[model samples]
Target: MKPVISRSFLDRLFAAQDYDGLVQLSSFFQGTSTCRLEKADYGLPRPFFLIVESLVWFAQADRSGVWTYFEATSAPRQQAMLEALTAGAPAGFAQAYAKGVSGWRDEAGMAGLDRWLSARDDENNRWLWQLARANRAQIDELLS
Candidate 1:
């Protein structure tokens, strides 16, 4: 019931966690042209956009592999995703993510991503969902 902000299509997409729907919806928003998660400039609410961005990265990595994410994403976008994680996830969550990137630089590239992936047990990222739920009114209002 979060995102009680707007009555727009964004409200439905966010509440459903409709990944593809949100991706498509984002294109009509302010900052995205390619609907890339790393764009991070959706011109929506800050924490809302950050949460969605972080989850999209999580979702994409879950569908593909973490290495695939790293491979397909540019360094700046990777940095943006990391920043999104920092903004949206619990403090503990950021540690594993940051560690993986650093560990990859430790010359254990694939291993680093694998470790990070394994460390994340909650695929749904209920914590972030909870955040959205808590701020539903604000998010929805903004979208509206």
Candidate 2:
């Protein structure tokens, strides 16, 4: 199956990290079904599912949106995690799986995501964290 979204698209979206852009992009993803479909794809890391999930949350409110943008843009570790996941996963399962299996270092990615989202000082970061949490929960459910 074709991947629903592009890594560059996500990278740009994350890089933009603006409330207006996030809402626009989130709406686009919601309309296109990119985030939901991508989450369902078995080949990608569950953490990414969380990233997008939090995006939806971030898109919901004007103030929260600002926080969302601030957190994503300011947090280098989170960005690095996203970058690593992006490099490994890119835009498709075919690529993501190949890189994932060849020692793609998913644990660090997950840990980074977990730390960023779970931190209490980051009310701004919670939306993304929730998304990540949801993704992990889904994967855990599947594994269990």
In candidate 1, stretches whose alpha carbon ends up further than 4 angstroms from where it belongs are 1-40, 103-112, 115-124
Give TM per candidate: 0.57, 0.25
User: Pick by lDDT: which candidate is best?
Assistant: 1
Local error of candidate 2 at residue 53 (angstroms): 11
TM-score of 1: 0.57
In terms of TM-score, which candidate is strongest? 1
**In candidate 2, where is summed lDDT lowest over 10 consecutive residues?**
93-102
Can you give the lDDT of residue 140 in candidate 2?
32
Error of 2 at 82 (Å): 28
Off by over 4 Å in 2: 1-4, 33-144
